[model samples]
Every structure is written in structure tokens, then in C-alpha cells.
Target: MEKIPILRMGDFLLVTIQIDMHDQLALKLQDDLSNAIQQHASKGVLIDISTLEMVDSFIGRMVADISGMGRILGAQTILVGMQPAVAITLVELGLSLPGVATALNVERGMEILRRKIAADGTDERPG
Candidate 1:
């Protein structure tokens, strides 16, 4: 399979993690995120969950893995647009995301990333 796609929006590296409901995408996640952080030098990461139908234990483990790897890669991972039902199911299935950063949506996630960048004095808004 091809490497997962990761895009950059401001200081956030937007990761649209690709995976089947029952498959393992963790190693690919690590590789793709490694490329993203290296390529863009971003301060944060966002996983768009609006496209996911179900997140199982394996995926949850992947999320935790990505979060830890992201920290070492110099980016904090965040989950965005996670459907409440999916979130509930993940929790009910005993899957925790291991302190990965999370946001209600991509916009919020970008804001968080921007805040982090700004805290580091990198604010350069286009006029």
C-alpha cells in the first residue's frame, strides 16, 4: 500500500489517517508522520476523524503510537471531528487514545497549532 497522505495547514500537520476498520495502520502511520514532520517542520498534528466509521482497538493502539512518535518528531498529535458515537464506542471498547491532543474540528485544531506557534513567536498572518 502507498504511504498515508499528510498535509500541512499553518503550523498543524493535517493527517488524514487511512485505514480499514479491521486492519493495522500503525506502522504506516509512523512512517507517514515521520515524513510529514520532517518535510514541513510543523509544531502540531491533526487527525481528521470525520471520515472514519469505526475505530477499533488496533486503531486506538495506532493512535497512541502516533502520539508518542509525534512527540519525538516534534509534533503533538490531535484528533479532530471525532464523532461522538465513535468516541463512545472506542471508550466502551476499552480503547483510550493515550493523551493525544484532540479538537472538535480541523479549524479548532489549527487554532491550537497556531497558538503553539505563536507561543514560540512564529505568528505571520497573511494580510
Candidate 2:
């Protein structure tokens, strides 16, 4: 029963997946992230998945769901750090993660999220 941590950084939430997540853990993470977005009134979510070597359909769907949920909550979601092999496997497994924003690393992800929030007129002022 591993719990993923959601860290708050200014107007964004950072979710760093440090281990290969299982089904239950992934679901819990999705729930936690949604709650954090609302609780913090976050403008964005950056998920770092660099440590994961593989992802199943369940995990892939969870990631997609998290992105969708973030959007519904008025937050932008960026998934970062996907290894090339892992990404290829996800595509081969038919999980392209449609409508999800991806980046090569956390730095780029933050830049994208910030730009999207600004473009959406989210008013990301210091609180």
C-alpha cells in the first residue's frame, strides 16, 4: 500500500511517481490528485513518471483520467519523464493517452503548464 505524494509548488501541484505503481496505488493517486487540485485551487498539475519502466492499461487510464479530472477542475495537467521504450509500449498497448499533455522533463512540463494557465486567463497571482 504505497502512497504517492502530491507536493504543492506555487499554483501547481507536483506528483512524482518514484516507483512502479500498481492498480490500487494508481487509483489512489488519481483520487488524491483530484482532491489536491480543488483543495489548493491549483492552476496546474505536473506528473513525473521517469522512474516507471512500464505502464499497463489500468495505469495508463488512470493517468488519462487524472488529466481529464484536472481539466474539469480548471487545472492544466502535464505528464513528464516518459522513457522512449515505455512510451512505445504504451502505444503498442493502444494507450496513446489522448488529450494528455506530455513533456520530456519536469522543467518543460512546468513551462507548458504555466503558459497554458496564462493563456486560459487563470490569474496565477501570488497568494
Candidate 3:
């Protein structure tokens, strides 16, 4: 099973999804992300889904779950690089990802995360 690499970036965790993940891999990513959030005490999470060509209901739900988990762990989640068609399909499939925040690209997402963390005044990352 291939694992998604979660990178620690200052006060955030970055996850770039490049491949079409299977169920197991997705589940593993959720677990790993949660653990990383707790271990790092990250202030935010940025997930880049640019290379993901398709997103079914399950994957969409997983993304939402990740966002919710991040919230519970005192981190904000911003999903980026979602293609227009993918967004439409997700909405059509009834997976609007209610609790998740989104940005057009990674750069924008990073900016959003930085601003959020700054406003919150709680930098969870250890020096």
C-alpha cells in the first residue's frame, strides 16, 4: 500500500494527492493526517488535489472527515486545486463538503491558512 506523504510546513501540514487513491489508501491518509495534526500540533492543514481527476462520494466524504477532524484537533483545513468539473460532480453527488474550506490553488490556500492562523493567534507548531 502506497502512503501519502504529509509534509510539515511551518505551522501547517501539506498533503498533495497526485494519484487516484483506493479506499484503503484514503483511510490510511485520514488516520495519518489526524496523527500528524496531533503530533505536530499543527495550526492548519492544506490538501492539494490538483492531480485528482475523479472524486467519488467516498473520497469526498473522507475529505470532509479530514476537515472535521482537523477542527476537533484545533486546526483549520483548506482543500485546494479542485478542478471545476470535480466540484460540480461532488455537488451533484450531494457531497458539498459542508465543513471544509477551499482555495483555487496551493498558493491561495497557503495564504488563507496563514491568515487564519495569524488571526487566531495560536501557533501550534513547536519551534
Q: Which numbered prediction scores highest in lDDT against the true structure? A: 3
Across 1-127, the per-residue lDDT of candidate 2 in tens digits comes to 5799999999999999988777788889999999999999999999999988888888888888999999899888999999999999998989889899999999999999878767767655633
Can you give the TM-score per candidate against the true fold?
A: 0.81, 0.92, 0.93
Q: Give the better candidate number (1 or 2) by TM-score.
A: 2
- Considering summed lDDT, which 10 consecutive residues are worst modelled in model 1? 17-26
The models' CA-based lDDT, in order, is 0.76, 0.90, 0.92
| Candidate 1 total steric clashes | 1
Residue by residue across 20-121, what tens digits does model 1's lDDT show? 533434566667787878788877888887878888877777778778877887787888888889999988998767678888988898888778767666
For candidate 2, give the lDDT: 0.90
Error of 1 at 106 (Å): 0.2
In model 2, what is the error at residue 104, expressed in angstroms? Answer: 0.6
- List the candidates ranked by lDDT, beginning with the highest: 3, 2, 1
- Candidate no. 1 TM-score: 0.81
Q: Rank the candidates by TM-score, best first.
A: 3, 2, 1
Candidate whose TM-score is highest:
3
Regions of candidate 3 where Cα sits further than 4 Å from its true position: 122-127
Model 1 regions more than 4 Å off:
18-26, 121-127
